[model samples]
Target: MELYRKTLTSATWWSLVIFNLLTFSSCKNQPESTVPSWKIKLIANSTSHVTYLVDLERAIDHILRVQLVQVPVFKGKELIVLQNIMALLDNFNPLYKYKKGKANIKNINRFIKSQTEVSQEYFKGLANDDEFATENYIGDDYIGCLGSQSGLRGFNCSLWNLFHYWTVQSSFSPELFQPGAVLWTLHGYVHHFMNCSECYLNFWFYVQEHQIEDVKTHDEEILWLWRAHNYFNRKLAGDVTEDPWFPKKQFPEDKYCRKCRWKGKWQNDKVLKYLKNIYSSISEVVGLINKEEEP
Candidate 1:
């Protein structure tokens, strides 16, 4: 009877998971791809509508594709790459904290710790599996685009959202108040999961070239990533993989922050303030900031 009860509970849990995924995929502006839109929101923002981190939600193949751009960077380096991969998944990305619905687990920090271990075990297993390969990965061509299709933003769009959200929470929470945590986490995630050789090397070189780890404060952390992202955007300005609708440019462009620029240079202080509000832990724009700054 106990075994039967456990089986029934497992079935029920997965049913809810699928139902929730379907509901989110049905969202109005979902990109034209197999992955659902709510999944997009789920990965993008933890403070988003769905409470828990859908950590094991996407299939392993899909998750790896999102970070496959890191593969080439790890090409020649074996031991160091393995160590960093472990650190990234185990320490930095505590991503699977939403394992609930059956029991009322009060200790969230404890729950997060347990769930994170399970996720890291799974991540390592997927990375080592010999069967997975770039040719068969569900990536750019797999999630094909048809000229500005919203549903086809793929991993790049999802990654951008995740990084922005990271900045917001890392700045606000005392427990997670580390300055350059996200940058290191991102690098570690790429080294282990991504398979895209060229993109992998470029990002590795780019961040290393810019010394992303040197950021000492939360404000610099946020702005540093924003700057790096803009530089990458300029590189991919006319690339075939870019989404047509979401044209790449210097983020928080001049139109959004006229005061953020002087001549051709960005005013980092003003830009930091503007970004803080947009990516705050809560939806501060509507409830906190005045209308004059909503743009």
Candidate 2:
């Protein structure tokens, strides 16, 4: 009888221990600091305005044709995703009323192809047999040049703009965040299209290591990119490829978001809201960009 009682007591104790362990593991995922620890002072002297997106957009177009246009080796779904990226961005087409329907990748690419017209000689002297050279001469301009020196404010910077723009634009969509739409497309693009073999691996590993797939809401998606990109900015702060004009730093610092900074950590809520405004509707962004462009 004593043996039976002892066995029952031991079983109850083990069950309680197992239950506590499972609960702790589950809560480990609940809101923790997304950034690596570092002390950063906010810079408030300069503002990179919305028109920067205009330059960024131009740079992106140039980069795609130059560094990102190699024939992708991806098969099936990922290949399709890469092709349809412009279509995905179609949600923002109506925002720029002055030039409607211009952002569509297919429409613009087709027009360029018509103007320059692809020829065997075009790729004859290039590094990749399938290199796509555009009539606009977008080579190494970081997608599209706005008086930017050849490599300054190029591919990497433009890529950051593209990511931020998509999240902001997509966040307002009727679909709200389509789970992995933006992230998956980006993953596929970098993995298959980027020129440098080493770059693709680094980006791929970072995405896998971070919980990008765990992003269930569009808000989560935006914050995740913000966190990830700021990390990128911090790491690349002094690298040679870093743009001279746009020095990498912890973005949206005290100047950008006065409320985001506390004694040490960021107020994640304020940061998310601030990003949404920065990457807000097409009309708001286009209006500001146009205003900046005016004489």
Candidate 3:
């Protein structure tokens, strides 16, 4: 009986592999030939969404408190890359709107920017800053990127949403950023600061495969991320770490945005419009900001 069970398990795993390969081959009509050149066995889905400002803020807090400070070696090019990331967040993170929050982030960014060298102390100190410690911005709650199961999704998921949020925010005010600035800075962060080694390798591979550096326009930057996100969705569909309640599906399912697709083919223009609408504003947080910003 033990031998039979082992054989059955092996067969089932192979079956899943074959099934996924067949699905990939069937997607010949996808807009981009997203045939990932390398395969890394880890869960990643760029479909992470940021519905509330708190979700993005929490993700940033996690990076500062958990990822950056824990870096085994925290100096040289790695330190500079993190500084650029903080600078981008200070300048454009939509969630950093209220005066106190804005001031806190700017101070952190400036500290890092002006430093020729930094230590884990800098990132650790950020967690204890008056505003960060007193405010509940990084509390243990999640709104947009929450997973059904505890370990299924959390920081990595919110991080993807944060990236999308940055792109959309940059689109609204292109003059505030150099072309591809946000994406390039994020690429550096993932390359140098992201704690997940496999995730970083795969992201780097995807960037190279897709020519992420070549993206130059605001609209292109937004769509580029959306496309890469969908590609990961396709790759990670039914992955073991996928939350059963949140089965990976190509984003903007017809129900969520009916015009996003037609006859099983994505309508890029409609999809772009849908993305802009959903990512451009955070209505839920506006009232909170109004209440908090009151003098």
Candidate 4:
């Protein structure tokens, strides 16, 4: 009887140890929690109107100075797409107040149009051209697109901001271009020039999956881009590349625009109004530019 009792006690002890080991192993193998440590909210100054424009200008400079020259191939449809992008920027870009900067945009467009095939060196020379002198006129630093980490969100974020800005500005000036021209141009740019293979594929698939060609009306185009941007935000949330300080969530969170949502549904008219106010409204633009230019 004594021997049996001792055996039973030992069995119980071993079982308990094994159960705990299994439980711990199971917990260890489980996926890491998606909940971030930092409280997520829109960082207020990150999205200021003038900062958006300034960042857009910086992004444009990056494109002219760096991104364009890196294009691996400059033939066939690629050349036409590049020319079209430059022409679109020359014609529709609203932020170019300085004469030399506007001249640079025009000169680049003309250069691409004149070239049957452009080497990377040719592009480099065009970017470095003394006649254009882009650095003298446009922003050379990023204000709104600065990420917490060294390379988290500078160029990619700036491009999206510029895309949204162009879409809104297009809505405000429909006669200057087609309703979907800005997005179409964006698609071509991403399809050809966006260096990240994964990012380019994601954008290409999204454009195809969502019927980007069918976006017809100006209002629809504005909202389409808004929705598209939010789609990317949702996709990239919690990604390793995400900036913790600027956590990706739906844009125009209630903190930014109270009327943008009600009962968890997007009030798109109010959202449109908000976008226009930030991107295209003259009074707001004047105020922001004044504040931005302040010494």
lDDT of 3 by residue, 70-104 (tens): 77555676766676677767877654555567777
| Candidate 2 local lDDT, 1-295, one digit each (tens) | 0100011122223223222211211212233323221101111123433424444455345444454444433234433433435445444432233232243344544433233233323322332323223322212222221212343443445466666777767777736347445655555454334432123233444545565458777777788778777766675567654434446678676766788888868888998888887666322232112233359
Q: Give candidate 2 misplaced runs (Cα > 4 Å).
A: 1-45, 48-53, 67-69, 72-78, 94-96, 100-149, 174-177, 199-208, 281-295
TM-score of each: 0.51, 0.60, 0.73, 0.73
Q: Model 3 segments beyond 4 Å from truth?
A: 1-50, 72-74, 97-99, 136-139, 197-206, 283-295
* Model 1 deviation from the true structure expressed as Cα RMSD, one decimal place: 15.1
Candidate 4, 105-155: lDDT as tens digits: 777777787888988788888776766544434445555565554555667
Residue 166 C-alpha lDDT in model 2: 77
lDDT score at residue 232, model 1, on the 0-100 scale: 69
lDDT: worst 10-residue window of model 3: 1-10
In order, the Cα lDDT scores of the candidates are 0.43, 0.46, 0.60, 0.62
Question: Who is ahead in TM-score, 2 or 4?
Answer: 4
* TM-score, structure 3 vs. true: 0.73
Predicted structure with the largest lDDT when compared to the true one: 4
Q: Model 4, 32: alpha-carbon shift in Å?
A: 24
Ten-residue region with minimum lDDT total, candidate 4:
1-10
Q: Per-residue lDDT for 194-259 in model 1, tens only?
A: 332222334444544566447887778888778776776787676554544546677766656777
